[model samples]
Target: ALSMPHGVRMRRIILPQALAIMLPPWGNLLIELLKGTALVSLISVADLMFQTRQINAATYLSAQAFGTALIIYYILARFLITPMMRWAERLVARRLGRA
Candidate 1:
């Protein structure tokens, strides 16, 4: 309010602050989205988990099949989504002058 008039304060101050505060939760939501994608297999979609289930059924190798799925999911989250989320958080921090 002191830095700007009421009308411009929302655009200049509130929105950026809101976005910066939302970054961490937004990253968590992304990770949840990745986990939720596994549910697509319940509807007969041929996602990674679905294929792993099929392989386990065919080969009767539950440990191998499920282990591979777990490893793949870990790699996807650790190498891809996690870094992207961290980068987004850092970018928000920098934009908000908190970095």
Candidate 2:
């Protein structure tokens, strides 16, 4: 048997494997949650969708306003969220000696 404390075993053995298995699905869930934030506009929260609606009402430009909002969401998920998730997954993999 290995001579290690419980915390050391967990940190060195369990967590990396768990994180590697979990990270991909977790990343997808995060992006989905970000998109779901637009629904908060229905409750009168001043979110991106709400701002888009305001722009649409003022200029009567549905495509432009909503399109811009779509682009913003895409940019956030693609540039920020996805990369961060990939980095975390790689870090976990490296820690597990699988990278």
Candidate 3:
């Protein structure tokens, strides 16, 4: 409350702290969004999942097709999305002085 007694403190202090705390859950939401996009295949949108299904239909190899899809999705989430989220969380934590 030292600076301006009440006004700018919320913007300067509270919002950053709140964002730092909320980022992990927001990351989870991102992962969920990635999974949710797979549903777009139902509408004939040729997403990864859709193409995997197509491969399965053509080759009659559900295990190989879906297994490859699962591995690719895992790699995307593990290597790409997860590290980005971790970097964001660390950046926020550092900014908030909680690192």
RMSD of each: 3.6, 4.0, 3.7
Tens digit of lDDT per residue, candidate 1, span 1-99?
896888799988898899888988887887787777774455576698779889999999999999998887788788887899899888878988999
TM-score for each prediction? Answer: 0.79, 0.80, 0.82
lDDT tens digits, residues 1-99, model 3?
A: 575546588888887888998999988987887776773455576699879888998999999998998887788788888999999999988888888
Q: Indicate whether candidate 2 or candidate 3 has the larger TM-score.
A: 3
lDDT of 2 at 72: 86
Ranking of all candidate structures by their TM-score, best first: 3, 2, 1
Candidate 2 residue spans exceeding 4 A from truth: 1-8, 38-46
lDDT of 2 by residue, 13-97 (tens): 8877888999999999989998988744555767998899999999999999999999988998999889999999998888778
The alpha-carbon lDDT assigned to residue 68 of candidate 3 equals: 90
The numbered model that scores best in TM-score is 3
lDDT on C-alpha atoms for all candidate structures: 0.83, 0.88, 0.83
Query: Stretches of candidate 3 above 4 Å error?
Result: 2-7, 39-46
